[model samples]
Every structure is written in structure tokens, then in C-alpha cells.
Target: MNILHHAVLVKSVNITSVAKLLLDNLLRHVREHVASIGSLSTMTVATLLDPRFKTLGFLSRNKVQEAVRRLKSECTALIASSEASLPHPSDAGESTNNSSELWCLLDETVDQKRQSFNATADAILEVEQYLVEVNLRRHQDPLEYWHKQKHVYPYLYHMSQRFLCSPASSVPCKSVFSKAGRSSANEETAYNHKQ
Candidate 1:
């Protein structure tokens, strides 16, 4: 099938999968970078204490201390920013209620789907926090964190484009699927009537 036809058939697939992929990749990149930094720090500390490396002890000690300070600052900022950005569960109740009402007005059959979507959104928010926590422990630089996050922007943009073109429904996928199904059914009926 052509691209457009394939897109129609896959209407039920959530575009958020793209976002999730980006988020996961970003997290993994950050984690690996942080791990490398941690390993380097350990090696630096180890070298500084080695008797054979005493000639370089003073310089190595200073370098290690500087690295530790930088790491600490990065960790603090990451934790603080993540905590600030987290979606409070209390807010979910209000937003969920509003979304549920909107979905009910659009299609009563999709109330459960709307709820599930909200739940998934909440879960993603939580996952973001968890990633922050895991990465913060390693204490990488803020610039590096931003750099890692930048990789996901294109994916996020693609997901946003899909979302924008999508129909207005409380449950995003359900709404898109319903619209597609309706259109196909109407086309089939017209074809039969013409016959």
C-alpha cells in the first residue's frame, strides 16, 4: 500500500510512541554519558592515591575536586528542575475531569479510552522524573544534559505534527480511528448506492 493508505490503516497506533522512543533514547544517552564521567572520576581518584603517581598527586587531586564540584552542581540543578516540572497528581484530577467531560460530549463510548490516555500521560510524566533521579545520581553537566535532550526535539516535533493533524477527541487515537472508520463506511455506502 501507499504511504497514505498505510497511514489510514495504522490510525489506531498512538503517535506518542514516537515521543516515547525519543525520551528513552535521550535518557539512555544521558545515562551512558554520566556513567563515563563517573568511571573517569573513579580512575582519577585511583591514580591520585597511587604511590607511583605521587609526582602528579597535587594536580590530579585538584582536577578530581573540580570535577566533583561540577558534578554536584549539575546534579542539584537537574533534581531541582525535574521536581519543578513534575505534574502533580492533584492537577490530574481536574484535567482528567475536564477531558472526560469533553470526551463524553464527543462520544460516550470513549470515556474509558480517555481515562486510559490520561493515565498514560501521567505515567510518562512520572517516567521523566524517574529518569531525572537516575541521571542525577551520576551528576553530569547541565550543558551536556541539554545537549542530550536536544536529540529528541525532532521526534517530538514529528509527534506534535501528527497530533495537530489529528481530530479533536478526548481519546486521541480513538477519535482518529472513529473519524477514519466513519469516513470509510460512508464511502462504502456511497459506492453501494451508486451500484
Candidate 2:
């Protein structure tokens, strides 16, 4: 976001023709690729959940709220869908021919758990708790962190499995700067040849 903002607003007449051309192309490409942060909600939410870069990459408070809302929406949906798939208390007896004491106890436990379940409140609390915690070290592995936190935030653990496994894009942003370095080196080599 900073790079895009700087690229668009930057203007200087003293720069070489090559630099001016590069800056123009960067702005054009940024516009072509990223219309707005809204388009990357999945990436944004994933970053918000990341222990290391939770709020670092965001540009504004509004964007942070937007991403958090998106995550909450998805979290509730996931919890609802999973709950819907579970065998109901009454259905449990029908599935098993044995009317043993163990099955009866299990059904009672399931019923009690179901009665206490509050998906919305739990989701909000878990998300808030996650945000309140200190960020993990920069070098720490987020997957490892999430793995250890699986029991602490069960729904988020499942959601992270869905979001964090794959990257937002095949081409990461760091590679763009690497490509620019090569282009600058080429320009330097050509300039030396001209002399």
C-alpha cells in the first residue's frame, strides 16, 4: 500500500528518463493489478489472523475493521455448517442398536454441549482474544503457532487450515523488487556500454 501510494504521488523532474519511465509503469501496473484493497479481503483476513503480521500490513483502521468483519462472517458460517453436519441427540440413539449406558451418557453430554453453544459470541470472543495477544516473533512460523493454538481457537484453526495453506498469489510482492533490481542492473550495464 505504501509503495503504491508513493508511486502514484511521486513527481520529480530531475530524475533520469529511465527512472521516470519505471515509475510511470509501476503506477500503471499497480492500478491494473490492485484496483483496491477490498478486492483482497481473503488475503487481508489471513494477514489479520497471522500472529506476526496481524495489523502491520494494513493501511487504515477502516480496512482493518473490514477484514475483521469478513473473518467473523466466514467463521460463523463455518461453525454453522459444521454444526449442521453433526448427528443430533435424538439421531444418535437411532444409529446405534445398543441401548447401553455409555451411549446414554454420550447423548446427554452432547445435548448439554449443544445447549451451551453460542457461535456468534464465541467467534467474537476468540477473534478479540487473538487480536489482544502479543504478536509472534518475526522469524516464528505462523503455521507452527496456529498448530499450537488449535485447541485455544478451534474454529480459527479450521479456518486457518483453509486460508494459510496456500499463498494469496503465485507471485509474491518481494519478487517484484527483485525483478526491479535486475532491470536496474541491466540499465547500468547498458549505460556503461554507451560510455
Candidate 3:
């Protein structure tokens, strides 16, 4: 984001004609291929969940809201599906007893179902709360925030898991071979100097 911002906004007359042309071409390519940060819902959500970015880093506010809404709906659907898969307490036996055991069983079933819905609601609430809070320091690890608050916001944390696993930037990995080659050459040169 900073790179793109500076690329366009920081132009000076000191730049040569060739460099200006190159900058324009680069901007064109970036606009064509890498302009919209919110195009991918997963990426946008991941950025939103990042402590450094949150909703504040979004280029488009509408996209941030859309991603959050999508996540909330997905969480609600997951809760509903899991609740549907559970065996009903009444299915255990057709016998209706006024016994405390029956009441306890029924109460447990209701509580479980309610808790599922409440969990989803809480997850959405957590996101909303996070959005309102001050952005964390850029140097702080966003995953650490997620880890510390996982118990408090399990649903959001779980939703963020898949997105978090994705590579944020491939530059480091891409440069590994070049870095290795440079280091090996330096080591060989040092060995020759000692000979």
C-alpha cells in the first residue's frame, strides 16, 4: 500500500523522462493486475482480522463491511448445520417422564442449541468490536492478538485460520535462491582470500 501510494504521489521533476515513462507503465500494470485489494474476500477478511490493518487499512469501506457480513453469515450457517446434525434428546426414548433426568436432558439440548446461535452472534460482535478499537502497532504480530483472544472469540479465530495460512507476500521466498547463491559466493571468496 505504501509503495503504490508513494509511486503515484511522490513524483518530482528530478525524475528523468525514462524513469517517468517506467513509473507510468508500472502504475498501469498495477492498476490492471493488483489494484483492488478487496477483490478477494478471503484476502480482505484476512487483512481485516490483522491487528495492523483491521478495517482501517481497507481501500474500500464497503468491501470491508461486505466481507465481514459474509463471514458472519457463514458462521451462522455453520452453527445451524452443526446443530441440525446433533441427535435429539427426545430421539433417545419416546417415553415421557416427569423425572428430573428428562428435564435435565431437555434443558441441556436447549442450551446447546442456544449456545450455538449465541456463539455465532458473539463472533460477529467480536468483529464489530475489533473494528471499533484502535489499530494495533504495525510492528505487533496480528496472529499473537488472535492467539491471545482465541478463547474469547473462537468463531472469528477459526474463520481466520484458513486465511491466515495463506502467504501475505512471496518476495522473501522468491529471493531465497538468489540469497543462497550470494552467500555461497561470499563464502568461496572469503576462503580464497585466506589461502
Off by over 4 Å in 1: 1-128, 133-170
Per-prediction tally of clashes: 0, 0, 0
Residue 164 lDDT (model 2): 78
Candidate 2: clashing pairs of residues = none
- State how far residue 106 of model 2 sits from its true place (Å): 26
The Cα RMSD of model 2 versus the native structure comes to 7.8
How would you encode candidate 3's per-residue C-alpha lDDT over 21-98 as one tens digit per residue?
876765554444433544666666666667676665444566667877876776676556666687754445555656
For model 3, how many clashes? 0
lDDT of residue 161 for candidate 1: 35
| Model 3 residue 103 CA deviation in Å | 18
TM-score of each: 0.19, 0.60, 0.59
Prediction 2 global C-alpha lDDT: 0.71
- The per-residue C-alpha lDDT of model 2 at residue 54 equals 74
**Each prediction's Cα lDDT score?**
0.40, 0.71, 0.64
- Which segments of model 2 are wrong by more than 4 Å? 1-38, 90-117, 168-195
Best-to-worst ranking by lDDT: 2, 3, 1
